[model samples]
Target: MKIRKQLPISALIAASALISTQAMAEVFVAPFGGYSFGASDFSITDEKTDELGSLKISESNHYGFMAGVTTKDPGDIYFLYSHQGTELRSGGSFSPNVITDLNVDYFHLGGSLYFPNGNLKPYVTASLGLTQMRPGDNYSTESRFSMGFGAGIEYQMTEAFSLFADARGYATFVNSSSALFCDGGDCLWSISSDIMWQGQANLGVKLKF
Candidate 1:
């Protein structure tokens, strides 16, 4: 009878310890704004004339937010959503000269590996996600698989807040089909490349809860 009573008490203590350890894990959200550049240029060709042209996505500002939970390791797993509004310009007689209103968005699931020292932590991050490209007017939106890799440093200001900056490079796989950016049988552009690339630099504040 005493052993049965002691077993219940022991189980209660074990459960309490597990809960306390979980409670010590940190949850954080970071809202960030950044400049994105180095978007790859696509080659365009006139099917009948055999003339070559070029298409470019302009450099622009992007914003995003990340929410994550710290693991037992000195790292965290996060979900990131970022968006950029820019222009697509055409050169060498590929028809429309410029699409002034274009948007690029990324939805990513990523993780960071951290090296901590005092109040500062330097980390490397990698993510895989989808990239959505939307152009204004009659153009259709295109979604492609993408990945990113980056490195950054964070300075902890207090127990609940920190500042961070990161530079990341993204690679988006272009569709193999010719139907991209098309609406109602009219196509805005087509390219032969398998991948498009871009780079970004971000600064943000991390809030912990």
Candidate 2:
């Protein structure tokens, strides 16, 4: 019996003259727009609070821009940064009118192993960032630390142009100790701390300059 040893994609890419050699790399920028849907959990304490039932938020539409870098040498490493904003609409025990709308802005930065074959190139990426969540008029917005891990495919149209679609889950820990109500004032009691998760599927174009 023979045993096969496998190396990580990063190491493999570096070994293949993949994209980690060139010093003067060209920047790749793309204006992307996409939609996202996810759940948000609310925590209440023993103090004064509004009576609201378990809630669900409508699927949201988001838009943003992305910019990255591609090396001149095939074996060089690549990096990308993206910032997206979305509006959240919710209904249930809160103010159906005012509380229904909120804003969430997410930031992501990661590295990839490029396979510049033809029109399509498959790659894997890992990123860590943050999300600033604003739950509307009365609710206080909080910034949370997030992390993402995913893979996607990139298709090239010309030497300096391409199209890409990717699906990745982003999450972070929320510290609600100084929490306040979304409807009005400070919370009677604040939430301890917990983790929240969100996922996104996006399709956009990329240009290498």
Candidate 3:
């Protein structure tokens, strides 16, 4: 991703207000990197049997890209893919032990509604998608239906380039009462909640063509 030096906030706002209003449809791709955190804990069971203990998803850094088209309505319809590789740990009162490595990924089709202020635009976005959880140690991967929502802003630096940032929360629906991450008849864990929640924040440069 290409990043530019920062400009004074007053100059940015002033220049944004002075920019001409012309509507043109465009296509854009944004590559972003950020941190992922605040994932809800899961209840672990051994071999689809008794509950062993609680497990927590560790906070980690993630990266993704968004590709979409700009609408004449001054908004964007985009597809987003994000990924984080973290560990699941056994929860303890003192210190937790790393249980295994886990990878969380999101694939979504989403849209953003922009509130344009000249060269600066703030937007609200929402998406419906699937979340894939892959665990190490020969555990089976699981995919669940998920949804996300967020708000962010973009600064248009040029006709074909911009900078954007956003924070989004995702919820993946899972069977809280049943076994999960199973390979064959052997299952590793079961979640405590019917919905697993996680959040991410991203910053990137957008290229429009």
Against the reference, the lDDT scores of all candidates come to: 0.88, 0.62, 0.85
Q: For residues 74-163, what per-residue lDDT tens digits would candidate 2 score against the true structure?
A: 422333444444344334454443243566777767667767676778776667777777666566666778887666788878878878
Which rank order by lDDT, best down to worst?
A: 1, 3, 2
- Misplaced by over 4 Å in model 1 are 1-17, 46-50, 92-97
Give the RMSD in angstroms, all C-alphas superposed, for model 1.
2.5
RMSDs, each prediction? 2.5, 8.9, 12.5
What are the per-residue Cα lDDT tens digits for candidate 3 across 6-65?
456667877766553233567889999999999987765554445466777899999999
Cα-based TM-score, every candidate:
0.88, 0.70, 0.82
Give candidate 3's whole-model lDDT: 0.85
lDDT of candidate 1 over 2-95, digit per residue (tens): 9999999999999999998798789999999999999987776544465777777889999999999987778899999999999988766666
- RMSD (Cα, Å) of model 3: 12.5
Give candidate 2's error at residue 14 in angstroms: 19
* C-alpha lDDT of candidate 2 relative to the true structure: 0.62
